[model samples]
Target: MAPSKPIITVVTGTGAQGRAISRAFHRSGKWHVRVLTRNPTGQVAQALEMEGMELVQGNFEDKGALLRVFEGAFAVYSVTIPPWHQQYDLSMGEYEQGVLQADAAKASNVQIFLFSTLPYVGPHFMGLGGVELYDG
Candidate 1:
């Protein structure tokens, strides 16, 4: 059976921005928001699920998981969160994750793709430039 409304995949749907975006989409009563999160049991994730969003367990590090979440979706909205444990910083890692997400969207044949991530800034500055490359 097919869904009545078009689907939009929201990456890191438990985060602040993802939550707002998901809520906006859900409130529209149009797009079926399919949200991916590492911790589905988290309070925010649970709340979003309660609001009629489809919550799926997944992480940015896994391309296969992202591909699965993006399947059959009309659009994909991705937001990359900087990893706290990494030594180098989020510039390289965030760009890598964005690349993976973009690739997944392409493979899924998503018509509209939106990427929200910090770019590669200088050493001290936040990674703000690399994200534009990834977004491209």
Candidate 2:
């Protein structure tokens, strides 16, 4: 049997950054791309699945689920959901989610891991030219 490619698990695989990262890994042909998302039946997730990526249905709030999501993976890439998406559920912010994922990655003994967060600029702030509305 031929040697298998390294696995790189991407969290939030249906989002913009996740999609880009997943695509880059697929294009390289050097690693098997695995994605974690809550909506595996969504169009984007289905598209990535069709492109040969393994999709793990999960959310960051559950570390146990994340550990499973990271299983058999050499690396994990994660970008916590941005502020805009948290409007409905304000229980956990991006930082909190990032920390949780980092802990899971460590526990899973992943070789490499990345955690990222991007602030959301509310629609009202878009009218203001060149101004960023960071809720810091």
Best by TM-score: 2
lDDT per residue as tens, model 1, 1-136: 7679999989977776788889999999999999998889989999998988998897667878988899899998888767653422344466788888888899999999998874334344444433343333
Alpha carbon deviation, residue 90, candidate 1 (Å): 8.0
Candidate 2, residues 27-125, lDDT tens digits: the string is 899999999988899999999999998888987688888999988889998888755673334357778888888889889889999776764444554
Off by over 4 Å in 2: 1-3, 86-90, 119-125, 129-136
Q: Backbone collision count in every prediction?
A: 10, 0
- Relative to the true structure, candidate 1 reaches a TM of 0.79
Clashes of 1: 10
Against the true structure, candidate 1 has what lDDT? 0.81
Cα RMSDs, all models: 6.0, 3.9
Candidate 1 residue-wise lDDT at 33:
96
**Model 1 poorest ten-residue lDDT run:** 127-136
Pairs with backbone N, CA or C atoms under 3 Å apart (clashes), candidate 2: none
